[model samples]
Target: MSKKVIYGIFDDEEILLNSVKEVRSNGIVIKEVYSPFPIHGLDHVLGLKRTRLAIAAFIYGAIGCVTAIWLTYYIMILDWPMNIGGKPSFAYYLSMPAFVPVIFEMTVLFSAHLMVITYLFKCKLFPGQKSSSPDPRTTDDRFLIEIESDDEKKISSILNKTGVTEINVKEIS
Candidate 1:
Protein backbone atom coordinates (compact mmCIF):
# COMPACT_ATOMS: atom_id res chain seq x y z
CA MET A 1 0.00 0.00 0.00
CA SER A 2 1.19 3.51 -0.77
CA LYS A 3 0.31 6.66 1.13
CA LYS A 4 0.49 10.20 -0.21
CA VAL A 5 2.41 12.74 1.85
CA ILE A 6 3.19 16.44 1.68
CA TYR A 7 6.76 17.72 1.97
CA GLY A 8 7.43 21.29 2.96
CA ILE A 9 10.92 22.76 2.58
CA PHE A 10 12.40 25.66 4.47
CA ASP A 11 15.82 27.35 4.29
CA ASP A 12 16.07 28.59 7.88
CA GLU A 13 15.87 26.63 11.10
CA GLU A 14 13.91 29.34 12.85
CA ILE A 15 11.28 29.32 10.10
CA LEU A 16 11.12 25.54 10.22
CA LEU A 17 10.74 25.54 13.98
CA ASN A 18 7.96 28.09 13.96
CA SER A 19 6.27 26.37 11.07
CA VAL A 20 6.37 23.05 12.91
CA LYS A 21 4.69 24.61 15.92
CA GLU A 22 2.04 26.18 13.78
CA VAL A 23 1.41 22.99 11.85
CA ARG A 24 1.01 21.01 15.04
CA SER A 25 -1.36 23.62 16.45
CA ASN A 26 -3.53 23.24 13.36
CA GLY A 27 -3.93 19.51 14.15
CA ILE A 28 -1.90 18.11 11.24
CA VAL A 29 0.27 15.13 12.07
CA ILE A 30 3.90 15.51 11.01
CA LYS A 31 5.49 12.25 9.90
CA GLU A 32 9.09 13.40 10.19
CA VAL A 33 11.50 16.27 9.75
CA TYR A 34 14.97 16.21 8.21
CA SER A 35 17.66 18.81 8.66
CA PRO A 36 21.37 19.08 7.86
CA PHE A 37 22.18 20.07 11.44
CA PRO A 38 20.26 19.40 14.62
CA ILE A 39 17.98 22.17 15.75
CA HIS A 40 17.79 22.34 19.52
CA GLY A 41 14.35 21.81 21.11
CA LEU A 42 13.05 20.17 17.95
CA ASP A 43 12.65 16.86 19.76
CA HIS A 44 10.72 18.52 22.55
CA VAL A 45 8.51 20.24 20.02
CA LEU A 46 8.01 16.90 18.31
CA GLY A 47 6.87 15.48 21.68
CA LEU A 48 9.36 12.64 21.61
CA LYS A 49 10.04 10.67 24.75
CA ARG A 50 13.43 10.55 26.48
CA THR A 51 15.83 7.76 25.45
CA ARG A 52 16.83 4.75 27.62
CA LEU A 53 20.40 4.45 26.28
CA ALA A 54 21.83 5.75 29.54
CA ILE A 55 20.23 2.84 31.40
CA ALA A 56 21.72 0.43 28.85
CA ALA A 57 25.14 2.01 29.28
CA PHE A 58 24.98 1.61 33.05
CA ILE A 59 24.06 -2.06 32.68
CA TYR A 60 26.94 -2.62 30.25
CA GLY A 61 29.35 -0.91 32.64
CA ALA A 62 28.19 -3.14 35.49
CA ILE A 63 28.74 -6.25 33.37
CA GLY A 64 32.26 -5.09 32.52
CA CYS A 65 33.03 -4.36 36.17
CA VAL A 66 31.88 -7.81 37.22
CA THR A 67 33.87 -9.49 34.39
CA ALA A 68 37.04 -7.58 35.32
CA ILE A 69 36.67 -8.47 39.01
CA TRP A 70 36.13 -12.16 38.18
CA LEU A 71 39.10 -12.26 35.79
CA THR A 72 41.38 -10.53 38.30
CA TYR A 73 40.30 -12.81 41.15
CA TYR A 74 40.64 -15.98 39.06
CA ILE A 75 44.05 -15.05 37.60
CA MET A 76 45.82 -13.41 40.53
CA ILE A 77 44.30 -15.28 43.46
CA LEU A 78 42.79 -18.63 42.41
CA ASP A 79 44.72 -19.82 39.34
CA TRP A 80 48.31 -18.51 39.47
CA PRO A 81 48.63 -16.89 42.93
CA MET A 82 51.55 -14.68 41.86
CA ASN A 83 53.79 -13.17 44.58
CA ILE A 84 55.13 -10.27 42.48
CA GLY A 85 56.32 -7.06 44.27
CA GLY A 86 55.76 -8.78 47.66
CA LYS A 87 52.08 -7.71 47.48
CA PRO A 88 49.75 -9.77 49.64
CA SER A 89 48.31 -12.64 47.58
CA PHE A 90 46.61 -14.34 50.50
CA ALA A 91 43.37 -12.32 50.17
CA TYR A 92 41.67 -10.75 47.11
CA TYR A 93 40.96 -7.50 49.04
CA LEU A 94 44.65 -7.16 49.91
CA SER A 95 45.49 -7.08 46.17
CA MET A 96 42.40 -5.11 45.05
CA PRO A 97 44.19 -1.76 44.71
CA ALA A 98 46.33 -3.08 41.86
CA PHE A 99 43.15 -4.18 40.04
CA VAL A 100 41.44 -0.78 40.22
CA PRO A 101 42.88 0.53 36.94
CA VAL A 102 41.92 -2.58 35.00
CA ILE A 103 38.42 -2.52 36.44
CA PHE A 104 37.90 1.15 35.55
CA GLU A 105 39.23 0.70 32.01
CA MET A 106 37.03 -2.33 31.40
CA THR A 107 33.95 -0.52 32.67
CA VAL A 108 34.55 2.48 30.38
CA LEU A 109 35.37 0.27 27.40
CA PHE A 110 32.18 -1.79 27.71
CA SER A 111 29.96 1.23 28.25
CA ALA A 112 31.30 3.21 25.27
CA HIS A 113 31.42 0.39 22.73
CA LEU A 114 28.14 -1.25 23.72
CA MET A 115 26.31 2.06 23.73
CA VAL A 116 27.47 2.80 20.16
CA ILE A 117 26.38 -0.63 18.97
CA THR A 118 23.01 -0.27 20.68
CA TYR A 119 22.49 3.15 19.04
CA LEU A 120 23.32 1.88 15.57
CA PHE A 121 21.03 -1.10 16.00
CA LYS A 122 18.22 1.01 17.40
CA CYS A 123 18.44 3.40 14.43
CA LYS A 124 18.52 0.52 11.90
CA LEU A 125 21.63 2.03 10.29
CA PHE A 126 22.95 -1.16 8.81
CA PRO A 127 25.53 -1.25 6.01
CA GLY A 128 24.14 -0.80 2.46
CA GLN A 129 20.90 0.69 3.80
CA LYS A 130 19.28 3.35 1.65
CA SER A 131 18.54 6.80 3.01
CA SER A 132 14.98 7.80 3.96
CA SER A 133 15.36 11.47 3.13
CA PRO A 134 12.65 12.94 0.83
CA ASP A 135 14.82 15.69 -0.67
CA PRO A 136 18.54 15.95 -1.43
CA ARG A 137 18.65 19.58 -0.34
CA THR A 138 17.72 18.53 3.19
CA THR A 139 21.19 17.00 3.51
CA ASP A 140 22.82 20.38 2.87
CA ASP A 141 21.07 23.58 3.95
CA ARG A 142 17.37 22.85 3.79
CA PHE A 143 14.85 21.57 6.32
CA LEU A 144 12.13 19.24 5.09
CA ILE A 145 8.90 18.43 6.91
CA GLU A 146 6.88 15.38 5.93
CA ILE A 147 3.17 15.18 6.68
CA GLU A 148 0.91 12.33 5.67
CA SER A 149 -2.34 13.66 4.39
CA ASP A 150 -4.73 12.66 1.65
CA ASP A 151 -6.19 16.15 1.68
CA GLU A 152 -3.59 18.10 -0.23
CA LYS A 153 -5.48 21.40 -0.50
CA LYS A 154 -5.88 21.76 3.26
CA ILE A 155 -2.25 20.86 4.01
CA SER A 156 -0.93 23.11 1.24
CA SER A 157 -2.87 26.08 2.55
CA ILE A 158 -1.52 25.58 6.07
CA LEU A 159 2.04 25.07 4.83
CA ASN A 160 1.90 28.05 2.52
CA LYS A 161 1.14 30.40 5.42
CA THR A 162 4.15 28.91 7.24
CA GLY A 163 6.47 30.44 4.57
CA VAL A 164 7.89 27.29 3.07
CA THR A 165 10.50 27.68 0.30
CA GLU A 166 9.05 24.87 -1.76
CA ILE A 167 6.46 22.12 -1.47
CA ASN A 168 6.33 18.68 -3.03
CA VAL A 169 4.01 15.71 -2.80
CA LYS A 170 5.25 12.16 -2.74
CA GLU A 171 3.75 8.72 -2.31
CA ILE A 172 5.49 6.17 -0.13
CA SER A 173 4.94 2.52 0.62
Candidate 2:
Protein backbone atom coordinates (compact mmCIF):
# COMPACT_ATOMS: atom_id res chain seq x y z
CA MET A 1 0.00 0.00 0.00
CA SER A 2 1.26 3.52 -0.80
CA LYS A 3 1.71 5.91 2.11
CA LYS A 4 1.13 9.65 2.20
CA VAL A 5 2.12 12.38 4.64
CA ILE A 6 -0.27 14.83 6.22
CA TYR A 7 1.32 17.72 8.06
CA GLY A 8 0.23 20.18 10.70
CA ILE A 9 1.97 23.49 11.31
CA PHE A 10 2.17 25.17 14.67
CA ASP A 11 3.73 28.33 16.08
CA ASP A 12 3.88 27.51 19.76
CA GLU A 13 6.13 24.76 21.00
CA GLU A 14 3.72 23.84 23.76
CA ILE A 15 0.91 23.43 21.29
CA LEU A 16 3.15 21.37 19.03
CA LEU A 17 4.02 19.07 21.89
CA ASN A 18 0.42 18.80 22.93
CA SER A 19 -0.63 17.96 19.40
CA VAL A 20 2.03 15.31 19.17
CA LYS A 21 0.82 13.79 22.41
CA GLU A 22 -2.77 13.88 21.28
CA VAL A 23 -2.08 12.30 17.92
CA ARG A 24 0.11 9.60 19.45
CA SER A 25 -2.44 8.86 22.18
CA ASN A 26 -4.95 8.30 19.39
CA GLY A 27 -2.57 5.66 17.92
CA ILE A 28 -1.60 7.65 14.87
CA VAL A 29 1.97 7.26 13.58
CA ILE A 30 4.12 10.33 13.08
CA LYS A 31 6.56 10.10 10.18
CA GLU A 32 8.79 13.07 11.01
CA VAL A 33 8.99 16.62 12.32
CA TYR A 34 10.64 19.79 11.05
CA SER A 35 11.52 22.88 12.99
CA PRO A 36 13.40 26.07 12.26
CA PHE A 37 15.64 25.42 15.23
CA PRO A 38 16.23 22.47 17.51
CA ILE A 39 13.38 22.14 19.99
CA HIS A 40 14.18 21.14 23.51
CA GLY A 41 12.92 17.64 24.40
CA LEU A 42 11.34 17.23 20.97
CA ASP A 43 13.27 14.10 20.17
CA HIS A 44 12.04 12.53 23.37
CA VAL A 45 8.51 13.68 22.62
CA LEU A 46 8.69 12.04 19.20
CA GLY A 47 10.39 8.89 20.58
CA LEU A 48 13.16 9.24 18.02
CA LYS A 49 16.28 7.15 18.38
CA ARG A 50 19.63 8.89 18.41
CA THR A 51 21.32 9.17 15.04
CA ARG A 52 24.52 7.20 14.28
CA LEU A 53 25.87 9.77 11.88
CA ALA A 54 28.67 10.66 14.27
CA ILE A 55 29.76 7.06 14.48
CA ALA A 56 29.82 6.80 10.71
CA ALA A 57 31.86 10.00 10.55
CA PHE A 58 34.37 8.62 13.02
CA ILE A 59 34.82 5.47 10.98
CA TYR A 60 35.26 7.43 7.78
CA GLY A 61 37.79 9.67 9.48
CA ALA A 62 39.75 6.67 10.67
CA ILE A 63 39.79 5.29 7.14
CA GLY A 64 41.11 8.58 5.90
CA CYS A 65 43.83 8.60 8.54
CA VAL A 66 45.03 5.14 7.50
CA THR A 67 44.94 6.05 3.85
CA ALA A 68 46.88 9.25 4.41
CA ILE A 69 49.52 7.51 6.49
CA TRP A 70 50.00 4.74 3.95
CA LEU A 71 50.12 7.11 1.03
CA THR A 72 52.64 9.45 2.66
CA TYR A 73 54.85 6.63 3.85
CA TYR A 74 54.83 4.93 0.43
CA ILE A 75 55.53 8.10 -1.48
CA MET A 76 58.14 9.64 0.83
CA ILE A 77 59.99 6.55 2.01
CA LEU A 78 59.56 3.86 -0.59
CA ASP A 79 58.90 5.50 -3.95
CA TRP A 80 61.24 8.49 -3.95
CA PRO A 81 63.37 8.04 -0.82
CA MET A 82 64.73 11.59 -0.74
CA ASN A 83 67.14 12.23 2.10
CA ILE A 84 67.18 15.92 3.03
CA GLY A 85 70.43 16.98 4.69
CA GLY A 86 71.56 14.32 7.24
CA LYS A 87 68.02 13.26 8.13
CA PRO A 88 66.95 9.74 7.33
CA SER A 89 64.37 9.38 4.52
CA PHE A 90 62.21 6.67 6.15
CA ALA A 91 62.21 8.26 9.60
CA TYR A 92 58.57 7.61 10.43
CA TYR A 93 58.85 9.02 13.94
CA LEU A 94 60.90 12.10 13.03
CA SER A 95 58.70 12.99 10.06
CA MET A 96 55.53 12.70 12.15
CA PRO A 97 55.43 16.48 12.65
CA ALA A 98 55.23 17.07 8.90
CA PHE A 99 52.55 14.38 8.51
CA VAL A 100 50.30 16.00 11.13
CA PRO A 101 48.85 18.61 8.78
CA VAL A 102 48.07 16.13 6.01
CA ILE A 103 46.55 13.66 8.47
CA PHE A 104 44.31 16.30 10.00
CA GLU A 105 43.20 17.58 6.61
CA MET A 106 42.38 14.10 5.36
CA THR A 107 40.40 13.25 8.48
CA VAL A 108 38.27 16.36 8.23
CA LEU A 109 37.81 16.00 4.49
CA PHE A 110 36.68 12.39 4.67
CA SER A 111 34.41 12.87 7.69
CA ALA A 112 32.61 15.91 6.32
CA HIS A 113 32.12 14.69 2.76
CA LEU A 114 31.25 11.14 3.76
CA MET A 115 28.86 12.24 6.48
CA VAL A 116 26.95 14.51 4.08
CA ILE A 117 26.78 11.79 1.44
CA THR A 118 25.67 9.23 3.98
CA TYR A 119 23.03 11.52 5.45
CA LEU A 120 21.61 12.27 2.01
CA PHE A 121 21.62 8.58 1.08
CA LYS A 122 20.01 7.60 4.36
CA CYS A 123 17.24 10.17 3.86
CA LYS A 124 16.83 9.23 0.17
CA LEU A 125 17.59 12.81 -0.84
CA PHE A 126 19.47 12.20 -4.05
CA PRO A 127 19.47 14.52 -7.04
CA GLY A 128 16.12 14.92 -8.80
CA GLN A 129 14.38 13.13 -5.92
CA LYS A 130 11.08 14.77 -5.09
CA SER A 131 10.21 14.57 -1.42
CA SER A 132 7.17 16.19 0.09
CA SER A 133 7.62 19.09 2.45
CA PRO A 134 4.42 20.51 3.88
CA ASP A 135 5.17 24.19 3.37
CA PRO A 136 8.23 26.32 2.73
CA ARG A 137 7.25 28.48 5.70
CA THR A 138 7.69 25.45 7.92
CA THR A 139 11.41 25.70 7.26
CA ASP A 140 11.57 29.34 8.25
CA ASP A 141 9.43 29.98 11.30
CA ARG A 142 7.02 27.11 11.93
CA PHE A 143 7.09 23.69 13.48
CA LEU A 144 5.71 20.84 11.38
CA ILE A 145 4.50 17.41 12.31
CA GLU A 146 4.35 14.99 9.40
CA ILE A 147 2.22 11.92 9.89
CA GLU A 148 1.60 8.89 7.73
CA SER A 149 -2.05 8.33 7.07
CA ASP A 150 -4.53 7.29 4.40
CA ASP A 151 -7.75 8.56 5.90
CA GLU A 152 -8.05 12.23 5.08
CA LYS A 153 -11.13 12.82 7.19
CA LYS A 154 -9.56 11.29 10.28
CA ILE A 155 -6.37 13.31 9.77
CA SER A 156 -8.27 16.55 9.35
CA SER A 157 -10.25 15.82 12.47
CA ILE A 158 -7.07 15.21 14.43
CA LEU A 159 -5.52 18.43 13.20
CA ASN A 160 -8.59 20.38 14.18
CA LYS A 161 -8.73 18.84 17.61
CA THR A 162 -5.03 19.47 18.18
CA GLY A 163 -5.33 23.20 17.39
CA VAL A 164 -3.09 23.20 14.37
CA THR A 165 -2.46 26.64 12.89
CA GLU A 166 -2.26 25.39 9.33
CA ILE A 167 -2.24 22.06 7.53
CA ASN A 168 -1.23 20.51 4.23
CA VAL A 169 -1.34 17.08 2.63
CA LYS A 170 1.23 15.64 0.28
CA GLU A 171 1.25 12.28 -1.43
CA ILE A 172 4.62 10.55 -1.53
CA SER A 173 4.40 9.00 -4.98
Candidate 3:
Protein backbone atom coordinates (compact mmCIF):
# COMPACT_ATOMS: atom_id res chain seq x y z
CA MET A 1 0.00 0.00 0.00
CA SER A 2 1.12 3.53 -0.74
CA LYS A 3 1.14 6.38 1.78
CA LYS A 4 0.98 10.12 1.60
CA VAL A 5 3.72 12.38 2.96
CA ILE A 6 4.05 16.12 3.40
CA TYR A 7 7.48 17.69 3.06
CA GLY A 8 7.82 21.02 4.80
CA ILE A 9 10.81 22.98 3.53
CA PHE A 10 12.36 25.84 5.39
CA ASP A 11 15.25 28.16 4.56
CA ASP A 12 16.32 28.87 8.14
CA GLU A 13 17.21 26.46 10.90
CA GLU A 14 15.61 28.53 13.64
CA ILE A 15 12.33 28.59 11.86
CA LEU A 16 12.60 24.88 11.20
CA LEU A 17 13.26 24.14 14.84
CA ASN A 18 10.38 26.27 16.05
CA SER A 19 8.08 24.80 13.44
CA VAL A 20 8.89 21.28 14.62
CA LYS A 21 7.97 22.12 18.21
CA GLU A 22 4.83 23.95 17.19
CA VAL A 23 3.70 21.24 14.78
CA ARG A 24 4.19 18.48 17.31
CA SER A 25 2.35 20.50 19.91
CA ASN A 26 -0.59 20.51 17.56
CA GLY A 27 -0.78 16.71 17.80
CA ILE A 28 1.01 15.97 14.51
CA VAL A 29 3.66 13.29 14.14
CA ILE A 30 6.78 14.10 12.15
CA LYS A 31 8.27 11.12 10.38
CA GLU A 32 11.76 12.60 10.06
CA VAL A 33 13.78 15.76 9.61
CA TYR A 34 16.71 16.49 7.28
CA SER A 35 19.17 19.32 7.36
CA PRO A 36 22.45 20.56 5.91
CA PHE A 37 24.34 20.60 9.21
CA PRO A 38 23.83 19.55 12.79
CA ILE A 39 21.17 21.66 14.51
CA HIS A 40 21.69 21.64 18.24
CA GLY A 41 18.54 21.10 20.36
CA LEU A 42 16.57 19.99 17.33
CA ASP A 43 16.47 16.43 18.61
CA HIS A 44 14.99 17.54 21.89
CA VAL A 45 12.46 19.71 20.13
CA LEU A 46 11.55 16.75 17.95
CA GLY A 47 11.31 14.50 20.99
CA LEU A 48 13.72 11.91 19.58
CA LYS A 49 15.09 9.27 21.94
CA ARG A 50 18.77 9.31 22.78
CA THR A 51 20.95 6.89 20.83
CA ARG A 52 22.54 3.90 22.64
CA LEU A 53 25.56 3.51 20.40
CA ALA A 54 27.89 4.33 23.27
CA ILE A 55 26.72 1.26 25.14
CA ALA A 56 27.37 -0.91 22.10
CA ALA A 57 30.85 0.54 21.74
CA PHE A 58 31.64 -0.15 25.38
CA ILE A 59 30.59 -3.77 25.02
CA TYR A 60 32.72 -4.17 21.90
CA GLY A 61 35.72 -2.66 23.66
CA ALA A 62 35.30 -5.07 26.55
CA ILE A 63 35.29 -8.03 24.13
CA GLY A 64 38.48 -6.75 22.56
CA CYS A 65 40.10 -6.31 25.96
CA VAL A 66 39.27 -9.89 26.92
CA THR A 67 40.55 -11.26 23.60
CA ALA A 68 43.77 -9.33 23.91
CA ILE A 69 44.35 -10.61 27.43
CA TRP A 70 43.75 -14.20 26.38
CA LEU A 71 45.94 -13.93 23.29
CA THR A 72 48.85 -12.34 25.15
CA TYR A 73 48.66 -14.75 28.10
CA TYR A 74 48.52 -17.84 25.86
CA ILE A 75 51.43 -16.76 23.66
CA MET A 76 53.74 -15.40 26.34
CA ILE A 77 52.86 -17.52 29.35
CA LEU A 78 51.51 -20.89 28.21
CA ASP A 79 52.12 -21.64 24.52
CA TRP A 80 55.72 -20.40 24.33
CA PRO A 81 56.91 -19.46 27.75
CA MET A 82 59.87 -17.08 27.42
CA ASN A 83 61.79 -15.42 30.26
CA ILE A 84 62.03 -11.76 29.34
CA GLY A 85 63.80 -9.20 31.60
CA GLY A 86 64.07 -11.74 34.42
CA LYS A 87 60.27 -12.04 34.65
CA PRO A 88 58.97 -15.56 35.28
CA SER A 89 57.86 -17.30 32.05
CA PHE A 90 54.49 -18.40 33.46
CA ALA A 91 53.68 -15.37 35.62
CA TYR A 92 51.05 -13.31 33.75
CA TYR A 93 50.70 -10.82 36.58
CA LEU A 94 54.45 -10.29 36.83
CA SER A 95 54.56 -8.95 33.23
CA MET A 96 51.14 -7.38 33.09
CA PRO A 97 52.59 -3.89 32.62
CA ALA A 98 54.03 -4.93 29.27
CA PHE A 99 50.57 -6.10 28.15
CA VAL A 100 48.69 -2.92 29.10
CA PRO A 101 49.51 -1.05 25.88
CA VAL A 102 48.47 -3.99 23.73
CA ILE A 103 45.24 -4.40 25.64
CA PHE A 104 44.33 -0.72 25.40
CA GLU A 105 45.13 -0.58 21.68
CA MET A 106 43.10 -3.69 20.96
CA THR A 107 40.13 -2.39 22.91
CA VAL A 108 40.15 0.94 21.08
CA LEU A 109 40.63 -0.68 17.69
CA PHE A 110 37.81 -3.19 18.21
CA SER A 111 35.39 -0.58 19.50
CA ALA A 112 36.05 1.90 16.72
CA HIS A 113 35.89 -0.62 13.89
CA LEU A 114 32.91 -2.60 15.19
CA MET A 115 30.93 0.54 16.04
CA VAL A 116 31.47 1.94 12.56
CA ILE A 117 30.41 -1.32 10.91
CA THR A 118 27.37 -1.58 13.14
CA TYR A 119 26.41 2.02 12.42
CA LEU A 120 26.68 1.45 8.70
CA PHE A 121 24.45 -1.60 8.91
CA LYS A 122 21.97 0.15 11.16
CA CYS A 123 21.57 3.02 8.69
CA LYS A 124 21.53 0.73 5.64
CA LEU A 125 24.33 2.84 4.22
CA PHE A 126 27.20 1.65 2.05
CA PRO A 127 28.93 2.42 -1.23
CA GLY A 128 26.58 2.83 -4.18
CA GLN A 129 23.45 2.85 -2.04
CA LYS A 130 20.64 4.98 -3.36
CA SER A 131 19.93 8.18 -1.47
CA SER A 132 16.58 8.67 0.28
CA SER A 133 16.47 12.42 0.74
CA PRO A 134 13.13 13.81 -0.46
CA ASP A 135 14.81 16.96 -1.79
CA PRO A 136 18.33 17.28 -3.14
CA ARG A 137 18.51 20.86 -1.92
CA THR A 138 18.23 19.63 1.66
CA THR A 139 21.84 18.44 1.49
CA ASP A 140 23.07 21.95 0.80
CA ASP A 141 21.14 24.77 2.48
CA ARG A 142 17.60 23.68 3.16
CA PHE A 143 15.79 21.73 5.88
CA LEU A 144 12.87 19.35 5.48
CA ILE A 145 10.22 18.00 7.83
CA GLU A 146 8.58 14.81 6.62
CA ILE A 147 5.06 14.25 7.92
CA GLU A 148 2.95 11.27 6.98
CA SER A 149 -0.77 11.83 7.09
CA ASP A 150 -3.88 10.91 5.18
CA ASP A 151 -5.51 14.36 5.32
CA GLU A 152 -3.55 16.59 2.99
CA LYS A 153 -5.52 19.70 3.84
CA LYS A 154 -5.01 19.19 7.55
CA ILE A 155 -1.23 18.75 7.27
CA SER A 156 -0.96 21.59 4.78
CA SER A 157 -2.94 23.89 7.03
CA ILE A 158 -0.59 23.15 9.92
CA LEU A 159 2.60 23.70 7.91
CA ASN A 160 1.21 26.84 6.26
CA LYS A 161 0.96 28.52 9.65
CA THR A 162 4.49 27.41 10.65
CA GLY A 163 6.29 29.71 8.15
CA VAL A 164 7.41 26.96 5.81
CA THR A 165 8.98 28.32 2.63
CA GLU A 166 7.64 25.53 0.54
CA ILE A 167 5.51 22.40 0.93
CA ASN A 168 5.61 19.29 -1.25
CA VAL A 169 3.26 16.38 -0.95
CA LYS A 170 3.72 12.98 -2.61
CA GLU A 171 2.51 9.42 -2.43
CA ILE A 172 5.00 6.65 -1.71
CA SER A 173 4.36 3.12 -2.91
lDDT per residue (tens digit) for residues 1-173 in model 1: 45688999999999999899999998989999999998999998888888999999999999999999999999999998977877758889989999999999999999999999999999988899989997888889999999998888888888889899899997767
Per-residue lDDT value at 122 in model 3 = 88
Q: Tens digit of lDDT per residue, candidate 3, span 26-66?
A: 89899999999999999899988888889999999999999
- lDDT by residue (52-89, candidate 2, tens digit) is 99999999999998988988888888788787786778
Query: Candidate 3, clashing residue pairs?
Result: none
The C-alpha local distance difference test score for the whole of candidate 2 amounts to 0.85
| TM-scores of all candidate predictions against the true structure | 0.93, 0.78, 0.93
What's model 2's lDDT at 163? 90
Candidate 2: deviation at residue 35, Å? Answer: 3.5
Count of steric clashes across candidates, in order: 0, 0, 0
- Candidate lDDT (C-alpha), each: 0.91, 0.85, 0.91
Clash pairs for candidate 2:
none
Candidate 1 matches the true fold with a TM-score of 0.93
For model 2, what is the error of residue 126's alpha carbon versus the real structure, in angstroms, after optimal superposition? 4.3
